[model samples]
Target: MNHDRSNRVCPVENAGGLDNGIRKFLQNPRKILSPYVKAGMTVLDVGCGPGVFSIEMARMVGTSGRVIAADLQDGMLEIVKRKIKGTEAEKIVGIHKCLSDRIGVTDKVDFALAFYMVHEVPDQASFFKELHEILKPNGSLLIVEPKVHVSRSGFEEMLKLVRSLHFEVAERPKVFFSRVAMLRRLA
Candidate 1:
């Protein structure tokens, strides 16, 4: 619960830009997540704007798996609900409204995706700590920040905090216009 309100959270009004074809072409969710996600695995899409990554995650996880689409804005969650309605993904994707101070999810996830949204977090230490708590032992968290927003030094600072929290660097994946880090929770 260490979230601070000073950070800029994406408004629901601009959500359309987050889930469009142009973005999909540049940052295809399936290609970015296929290595980490699997059928029957429980996953999390943090700051899932308009369910872009959440919808794709639902497909990757299959019917036996679950994709938690957690966001602070109810408008964003509503968009996710609408996108999944009447689809097979409806049963696989769960929408959760995150608390201002924390993620507020109780279930431990096998994998978590933080795409282009970590820069929006005000208290990253607390944020990463909470993520550490919710990830199963050896579980992976893929953190992707927009290169346009987060500088190399800023991303290094984030990695320092991530390491201090007992998460090890799994790898650095190449992503279009993004600085990516795959972290694994220690057992």
Candidate 2:
């Protein structure tokens, strides 16, 4: 439960102009996640910075499913709350303010997405352990980090931690300028 917050991206930067069209073009939620997500599945979007992917996930999950959009910053969650104000997605998406140690999610999830945000976490091992607990048996977690920020060695270290937690690598999807790994919890 280490709370080292030095490298975390500030809430203000979470709303930067770069998060608009350019970011969406490169990291389209539907294109990147369609392979793993299905209808009626509860999904968790960790470090969901402005509802960019959360909104799309809500749609992908449809009316029967749920998308927990969790972030450390209240401002970030506020942005997501505003984005889904009057849409159908609003009914399925839940905005959660998470802490550095705990994600604060009790419901078991079918899938989880951690995009470009794992590097910002202070304690990787503890984070993964919490994820393992919340995810259903055989559930999948997709972790994508910025190549520019996380080096090959760093990413490998992260993978080693995940493996130690008994998560097996299911696939390595090619994401533009990102190092990606999809892992599944052991039953």
User: Best candidate, lDDT-wise?
Assistant: 1
All models, RMSD in angstroms: 2.4, 2.3
lDDT of 2: 0.88
Over 100-183, each residue of candidate 2 has an lDDT whose tens digit, in order, gives 778889999999999878888888888999999999999999999888788888888889889999899999999999999999
CA-lDDT, candidates in order = 0.89, 0.88
Candidate 1 backbone collisions, by pair: none
Separate clash counts for every candidate: 0, 0
> Which regions of candidate 1 fall more than 4 Å away from where they truly are?
1-6
Candidate 1 lDDT by residue in tens digits, 81-186: 9989999999999999888779989999999999978888877888888999889999999999887778788888789889999999989999998899999999
Top model by TM-score, which number?
A: 1
TM for every model, in the order presented, reads 0.95, 0.94
Residue-level error in angstroms, candidate 2, position 159: 0.1
